[model samples]
Target: MLKINDITNASSAGAFVVKKGFGAILAVTCLLGAACSSQSVEEGGLQPVALKEAATSASTQNVADKPNVLVLMFDDMRFDTFSYRGGPVPTPNIDALAAQSTRFDMAMTTTGLCSPSRAAFFTGRWGHRTGLDDNVALWHSRQTGLKDEEGGIIKRASDAGYYVGYVGKWHLGPNGMAKRGAEFVDTYKKELEEHERQGAPYGRMAQTKRYLAGERDENGEKNQYYLTLKGDYDDTQAAQKVRAGQEMIKSAAKEDRPFFGVISFSQPHPPYRVPEPYASMFPVDEIDEPANYMAKRVNKPLSQEIPWWPWHEVSHMTDNDWRESRAHYYGAIAMLDRAVGEIIQTAKDEGMWDDLHIVFIGDQGSMIGEHGLYDKSAYAYDELMRIPLLVRDPDVEPRVVNRIVSLMDVPVTMAEWMDLKPDGAVDGDSLTPLMLKGDSAITDAEDDALYAYEWYNGAWFGLRAIRTQDYKYVWNPGDERDELYDLKNDPGEIVNQIDNPDYKAKLLSLRKRLELRLVEVEDSSVTRLQRLIELNS
Candidate 1:
């Protein structure tokens, strides 16, 4: 990681000494130039300090010029939800970004959950390294000397003289003023006990009670509830969080140094709550059921053993309930999209549009009735593993890469764009070369198959999967069973081809490939244990 020493004698007087009219002219020229070059800048007229010859020369004499970075991340947003990806949701802001930026069609997450995925993103390492493999495990790992050695990307930027600010949902530890634990039963009990002891809102448990109990005034509105215990599905809370994020962006812009602002929104997760106008954005009669709406576990060759509560629960909901739920979900997405629009607009209003590098992605994907799953896990399926990754740099070519990439590539990619060295051992290679080459080398390269693992919810030890362009193979070490799917034929993963005689050889080869990768990345505890079990057997 890059470290900076305090310069006691730094003179601020020289930093702003541009000849009056010349500064104005330069800013205007850069704005106009950027506006003419791309639709991204044209749509939002925010131009940061341009890195032109004059600006470069000015910076040589004790002046500093760094690009502002804004990361917009949504919670529980499925990879297929965006309109750009041909999903049902009409995310215009995200679509516009995809149209004008480098969109990675196969950005796999290291883990399929929230904190673990975000930890991987920030540390440029997998879940095991960050000790955040699962929600509760994060705390346990922290106590056992398995601390997050890497302070994450935000801390890195901050250390490098960039003003850093994080707004909205921070699921990574310290409990976010919420007691951490299981969902309803044990976690809630512990939280309530802590709340009674502390006599205030201490953790998520208290926050849930406060929100649901309607303790806080909703902008002084008599009947309006300011907070709700409905998880991220509440659009009213989502909107307020969005508004808070906007204020953070504005504050970051006021900093003298370059800023790195992360606006993380929690929404479209569960409890399916939305405010009045947005709550009813989509009508029940107009809502369309998911393509695999009535899919059954028995139809799957893998023979589903785990009971998925949300999917099975939502599956039994009446058509009206489903429609209302769908409406609320879509409305939540729209609310998030509008929040993105607000941030973009604010950047424009601040005249820092062109000189900023923007990245938009999801913390983790939500399974809205795909294969009868509602949220993400380490299942290694496409819906859970794949995430939408879009990056917009002022000088890069705007194109989409269908080649496989991982979320771990994010920090390195951003580092490359900023001309900075990455802070740690990056598990993912930068996509810059492919971005520059376009679709020419995209199909030619033999990219490593994407991998994902999870150790959460007292489920299984871990689940591993390897995905190629046309084929995907999954291994559950605990069960000693595997699943294979020809993605070209079954994109929804409705069938398992693991036992097919014709593909038997291919399955073994893919299994070895996945095992070797697990060994290479050192992400396979179950694989090692499975090996010992096989030897004993």
Candidate 2:
């Protein structure tokens, strides 16, 4: 599905390359990707030179050196409890990192939150080039970072030499992520504020007594509400982000370089805590509901028919509080699949898993209660916008690419798998030719709509979306009832049919394709969807 055909002919050579439909050149090269900072130098960062490849397809184009990336990420994970959804959560280290990976069955995360999708996965740009719905005002935006006229992805993977380790949650800008690449980094916020001032992240309620049962404090030592046993797995927080991803993969394999690590985990988010055979492993009537659980509509808006606190208290929850928050959200995804199986068994005990290019993502995706919602706002439901992309690229092989992709294509698919070329025009465009032509017509199979944006919960949380794999078009320019969904017969977006009448011409052709993708991302919410189409025509 790589056919953006040079983003409208590289937006007339001002530059925006990588053609062949990654959601129509990610809104036409991020809408003329800021005219490649005034072009000229061979029209800015070239080297895509075309490919429709025929000579027996499959190729990563004669693999060029550079393959030592890690990137785990994972915060509010969703995609129905991964190991690719054989749910009842028990990830076995993300199903052994999705068994030699490439999993992505329709991924997404344009904006689900956590500093606007990790500032569009480290600056491939989105969320109005990282500003709206602020993540510390997009870590003080210079267009979501690495600015000196751009060269993100950790300053072009530390100026193409690699060795760039950034550990745990930086919520977008820890002083512009301590100026990008450091041979080693840490944003654990003072070890999570001294593990929440020694309450040890409320020790998941000492394995659920539901607060205050042997919970100590006031000059108390051992005040972390008691470790939720199951052998208090190193007092969890995904085991201190897997021991800071095993000390940054043993200090980047004793400084032999070629590293890129990024670990980052906060866990199945929220105080859901885990550890203890994954907090007594799943069983709340076998955790399965969400066909928009407790679904409702009435033209849903007003922050979705009043869903806020505990999803407006999900009808006084019980079934053991939704099976104890879905067994502590699959025991925080089996305590983050046992800290992603000790950071891939410390990168397969430092022999660095084959060629090691690992990348299991998820900066967003969660609506735990769905419809009766709860957290993650600026709605664009698909369980708070799909995310669970696993790519193992040791020159590709393992398959399954239902392709919808976009977590702003993870740093231009890591600057096109280290062939590095980051300088200007960046509005994402690289899945390495749809992960080397794996399947599902990855791009232009025409879901010709995949934008996402939402103000950081204010001015009525202005939202804007344009998903399309069978319809979804949110547009709450400060609420007035604007949403439509049909995701092939409601993929749990539980009915909002935008003033339905057999979907008034698919809601004005998805509001004129979301006003031409919010006018190629220079956006403004198209005059609030044209004032509800001139006050309802």
**lDDT, candidate 1, 413-455, per-residue tens:** 7655544545666676777787788656655335645566656
- Taking all chains together, the TM-score of candidate 2 against the true structure is 0.33
Error of 1 at 319 (Å): 4.4
lDDT of 2 by residue, 1-537 (tens): 211122123222222111000000101001000112111111112211111111112122333345777777766677767655777765676676677777777877777766667766776776564453443322112222223333367767666666666555544432343355454554432211211111111222232332224333233212111113333566443454466557767766665446676766555554354446665666556667756665665567776554332223344444455556656666666666666766677777867677777777777766656666644666788877887777777657778777577777768877776667666546666676666777544545345446565544232366777787788888776776778889898787777888779889878877777777666666666776777666655
Q: Return the TM-score for each candidate structure.
A: 0.73, 0.33
Highest-scoring model, TM-score: 1
lDDT score, candidate 2:
0.55
- What lDDT, from 0 to 1, does candidate 1 have? 0.51
TM-score of model 1 vs. true structure: 0.73
> What is candidate 1's CA lDDT for residue 424?
62
Report lDDT (CA) for all predictions.
0.51, 0.55
